[model samples]
Target: MSWHPQYRSSKFRHVYGKAASKEKCYDCVPITRSVHDNQFCAVNPHFIAVVTECAGGGAFLVIPIHQTGKLDPHYPKICGHKGNVLDIKWNPFNDFVIASCSEDATVKVWDIPKHLLTRNITTAKKELLGHVRRVGLIEWHPTANNILFSSGYDYKIMVWNLDSNEPVISKPVKILDAHKDVVLSMSFNTDGSLLATACKDRKIRLIDPRSGEVLQEASYKSHRVNKVLFLGNVKKLFSTGTSRWNNRQIALWDQNDLSVPLLEEDLDGSSGLLFPFYDSDTCMLYVVGKGDGNIRYYEISSEKPYLNYLMEYRSHLPQKGIGVMPKRGLEVSACEIFRFYKLIPTKSLIEPISMIVPRRSESYQEDIYPLTTGAQPALTAQEWLNGVNKGPLLVSLRPDSRKQLKVEKKLPKKENMCLSNGFDVFECPPPKTENELLQMFYRQQEEIRRLRELVNQRDVQIKQLELKLRNLCMNTGSY
Candidate 1:
């Protein structure tokens, strides 16, 4: 087709039906995107969110993959925040209600539904003034839907009780200094017990949300922290950093002992986490890497405290930056991602939804593709040599099962023998069809016949050359 998947023909049912009806609730936290959730929600693999221009100017926007359904009658101008919108998020309980933060120091709540965005009501949810600089992030409480948190360049993290549109405690509940330096990132744990913040101070300080007291701190000098996440099951935290260190680092901080990392693994050469979210149901952490041009899904378990580098998905967007949302429900692993580009204050977010669904990413496509050592799941040293399906990596010469390498001691040299794992080892299993063996025989004979015919042709050509040589000799002798 001449058009991209965004313009190509597709159906919503085809997309939604692909998600299995499995629903598991992940702890509410920020994430870049979740494929496990996308699969459940039925989002198309290439349907990543962009401040992207659709075929419709701004009137109505297509949801990426399946061609023509418009999200709203018209996009809401959302013009209250006097400056650029640094963050935008939807309320978990209410899909129509969205909240956006701006350098103008105002967080405006826009109640807009997909079908009718006409109720474009812009209410100044809360105007936090203490942060002399721009607000960096705004996150809602995982369980307490109305409670919100905003962290900023002023190095302070504020907790607000957005209990009502006009509240008694509309002011900051806690304005605690999150770091010794500028606080770059901050988020609440799944349980709301701890808040993990990644700072320019090169540290991840765990603070109690209620009192705004520093509960624990995990410091590292290898690289400055960009984003820190409190992983699923409430036992560990995941973090991402820059090029000075392994661009993507999964530091599993034991909840019991927050000082040292139980498992600190690098994402090979992958750039720092563009955004990351944890799937409470699958215990998977999906990370979107910065300009590295791929979205990676990693599985982190508190029980094991080790990150299983799962898969890497290629994105069709030319986005320089992005924000992600975790799979709200459980039927799948796909997460929602919004890709856009801009600079300066540098604040964007991947939010959370209460509903559960599969994730959307290229990995869900029905085709096989190559993977790097990091993208491939880690196999035990024995599994790689054993021809097990940790993943399809072993090379086999046999047509049926993969062949195993066997070392044989010959008279003078060692002979390397490749053995069949299952398919051709001993007596063949029952054939699928009655003519299967006959079909194989015919195929073999056809190959052999073709080879023999080529040999015979060569022989005839040799004979003809001999006759020509003999005639030439006779002619010379006669001369």
Candidate 2:
């Protein structure tokens, strides 16, 4: 019998339903001859936001996937951008708050009404203006609430604090002006310390957002880079772009040095851009190309050539846009790890595709559970501005049923063994008395306390020595 039954795709419903109709389509008439990997669709824990380019402009549709037709007679279809809506991202912390960018050259933050299923139209809660050209990218701070990052064709990356209650000009808190060409894509490391960007000038740059300095920069003369991403907890990067001869390629690089890529592979030339999505818990990277019908995934590990091609999922209908659901939104009961929403422009529908692990047991298996990526924010925006580098907030997604489903097993040392004399012998020693175990625990705790004190003393001495060296260098008139 199969060990895992819940992981099969045939068990779960694949098509959630079309989000828009012929009368409500976002981009009824194509304005441009191309569709870029804009990350146009975004899904939060509850709702999914999709950008459809309209003839005159574009519209943002906020539809409840579970309640698209049943709960609400009409879902909220937001029209705020004067031009095409380039991208939309839901706030990680707030389900109702969404940030969108447009060709109108502005980023608007919208706060959806409480009764989102019934609400038809929603307006912007705040408007941020700084980019002189079309704003195409927007990313919220993973850990810090009310903070956002945006990039535009003007070659500027602006960091804004959305906590401000003022209606005046929304001045950015910090601006990064390093890229000479248009920023094609921008992504933050898991902790939000480093910001990686791919530009049209064939360069990939890592910037320190807090200090506004280029931490590391590398350029490739081949083709225009499309995306730069940081995966898992490793100090490495992945980039997708075309080579000099117009051959598509995906390469892995070391974060410290970009003199040469660690691993590189060539793909068939296609007009659609490749969008990468990494799952830190499972160390899997899903690569989906815009306007393509297949999703290719690779399992990344610490071994050489980190990316190991896993498998691919193909559909008859090519996707115009794709949105991945957050980990928490996945169906854990079905042993599902990732869920994707693929937008079929021809049908004017957003179909759901789930990736599940096939398992047989009815129990919740702890061994096969996925670790959620970006579980917690490392530092608050205010703290980061204050020059603090608090590490990530680690969280656990262990369900309560896990403990109940676990079966206690004897350790190898404690199990019975067969002796040479053909007699069974217990390998484990008899259980120690309560007081004896307590004594051992106390001794271990004492050693831990001693080690901690030594560390503290060493830190204090190191600080004092640094101060003395600074004073000595100043007195000697040397740098």
Q: Rate the local accuracy (lDDT) of all candidates.
A: 0.47, 0.72
Q: What is the lDDT of residue 347 in candidate 2?
A: 60
lDDT of 1 by residue, 1-479 (tens): 49645432211112111211112111111122212111111121212222222231111111322222223434343445555456655454443445555556555554443342344333444454545666657776554445567766677777665554552234675677657676767776654556788887788888877667888887766655677777646577777665365556655667657666676656667543456766554455666655444556665644552666655555332224443432321112132222121110112221112222233562332111112111112333233223332321222112322112221212222222223443542323434543344434543554475569678989999999999999998989962
Q: TM-score of each candidate?
A: 0.53, 0.74
Best by lDDT: 2
How much is 57 displaced in model 1, in angstroms?
19
Compose the digit string of candidate 2's lDDT tens values, residues 1-479. 76855442222223122223333333322222226457678996557787754456667777754443332223347877788888899887666778888889989998875454454454688999999999989998776767799999999999998878865346899999998888888888877778899988888999998777998888866545789898737778889988877777888889889877888788777767888888777777888878777788887766675877767787777888789888866656557778887777776666677787777775665654644543345666687777665545644445443333332443344234555554433422222454334333443454475569679989999999999999999999994
In model 1, the runs with Cα more than 4 Å from the true position are 1-74, 113-115, 118-130, 164-170, 243-247, 268-273, 303-305, 316-318, 321-479
Give the best candidate by TM-score: 2
Give the worst 10-residue stretch by lDDT in candidate 1: 36-45
Write down the RMSD of all candidates, one decimal each: 21.2, 23.2
Candidate 1 structure, TM-score to reference: 0.53
